[model samples]
Target: MKTFSNRLYSDYLMPSRMTTHEDLIRAAQVAGYTQTSVRDFVATLRGGRDPQHKVLIHRHDIDTDLRTARKLFDLEKKYHIQSSFYFRLSTMDIRLMREIEEYGSEASYHYEELATFAKRNKIKDRADIQRRMPEIRDEFVRNFEWIEQRLGRKLTTVASHGDFANRQLKLNNTEVLADQALRARCGIECETYDQILTDHTDIYISDRPPPQYYHPVTPIDALRRHRRIYLLTHPRQCETNWSANTKDNLHRFYEGLTW
Candidate 1:
């Protein structure tokens, strides 16, 4: 189980995010999660056998980015990886969401909803955000409705968007779970890594990297050590073109490590 330091780097940041799909497959073969399509991923999830590969795919922020949606769909067709796409539902690309939803790729809400709701569509910085949680979530119900309307499907799973820069946004893991749970009570079913693991102990679930914090040690290492490893990637943040910091971060984490 090598660390996530030296992952084969490819991103869909370009209109051509899928050109490296083969490279990624080869890399996954090297990492050993040789899954090539959605069924393979499902089998990993449903079967007792561990996944045969350790892989990560990044799509670069699926907001109005239809290019990413289309490209990811195409690549998923080729590789059989039923990866997850995270969307910033508040300011998300609705058109892109509509397009991506058809591909059978699972979608998760990236909670920019809090910032959009709390700030009254006006707040922008972290200090203002942290100082305003009560004032914000208290006043932000519309944002939730907005998200529900946009996705067309109710959001059952959510990942917090990296938001410290936008609002002094500190999320308590439990608090986030509770907030999501309240929504679930209304049939929204918002679940996170902790919630899934705590409730579903019989199933071998993959909670490798914590949401939005993608240092890939556990996930990649998990792949190496376990037979049924699962890996996830972000579409909006993993390419060199989108954010050099994220690229460098992944490169450093997976730097010299090989499968």
Candidate 2:
């Protein structure tokens, strides 16, 4: 608990190390890159077309904090830049998601069906988790169809969401898409981690583990240096308020203890 608290304190309290999503996007523009959503990015690749200009594949996994996600949506809209926002079940807000789509951005699922199944069923053994793959895939399909039905559109892409249960069982949510047969069954054309995408991406940067200290170069510097970039962010990482961060930290801490 003490270790977690200190990490949160340093991460949220140190404003000097903070870099807003705005900072990174503006930097990309200054470096002569046009931002594109994951949906468009995948389509471009599959179409056998290569962009003539520098491209920034901007994506956000809305794990929590709907308000912060909106904060990002507003910032992106202000610049007339369209990016992808992948919503987990926990952060699903159909209205805001539709608003984002109306503004020309892509909104899709950040799925964690495997991790969720393992946690809820108390299935700890790796083999047991593996044996239940079909059930997990069914849950994923159900959620995917549910979201698509509500959004009133077909979803072509999805991104796997990670969780502690994934680590404990050495299973990934992406395992649901491990077979091409299943991918075709689900009608998902692409996932964020597909090698067809990652192989083409020149650099990948994320706000996880706090990019400020984790990366040797800041995101702005990365943009200046690399031509093709995949930028992933979580809305929770954008919150800078110490009190809110501390509250979230403790909530997660106690939640983990119970788990």
Collision count of model 1: 37
Question: Which parts of model 2 are misplaced by more than 4 Å?
Answer: 10-19, 209-216, 241-259
Residue 251 Cα positional deviation in candidate 1, in Å, after optimal superposition: 26
The lDDT values for all models are 0.45, 0.81
What local lDDT score does residue 88 receive in model 1, on the 0 to 100 scale?
58
lDDT of 1 by residue, 134-221 (tens): 5545433455567667678765545555443232445432233345535555354433344432332222322212232344344434
Separately for all candidates shown, the number of backbone clashes (residues 3 or more apart, or on different chains) is 37, 0
Question: What is the alpha-carbon RMSD of candidate 2 to the true structure?
Answer: 2.6
Estimated TM-score per prediction? 0.54, 0.89
lDDT per residue for candidate 2 within 1-259, as digits (tens), equals 8766657655575453224677777878878888989999888988999776799988999876677788888888888898999998877999998998898999999999988888778788989989989998888888999999999878888999988878888888899889787788778999889888778888888764543543445577777678888888776667655554566667667646655
Clashing pairs in 2: none
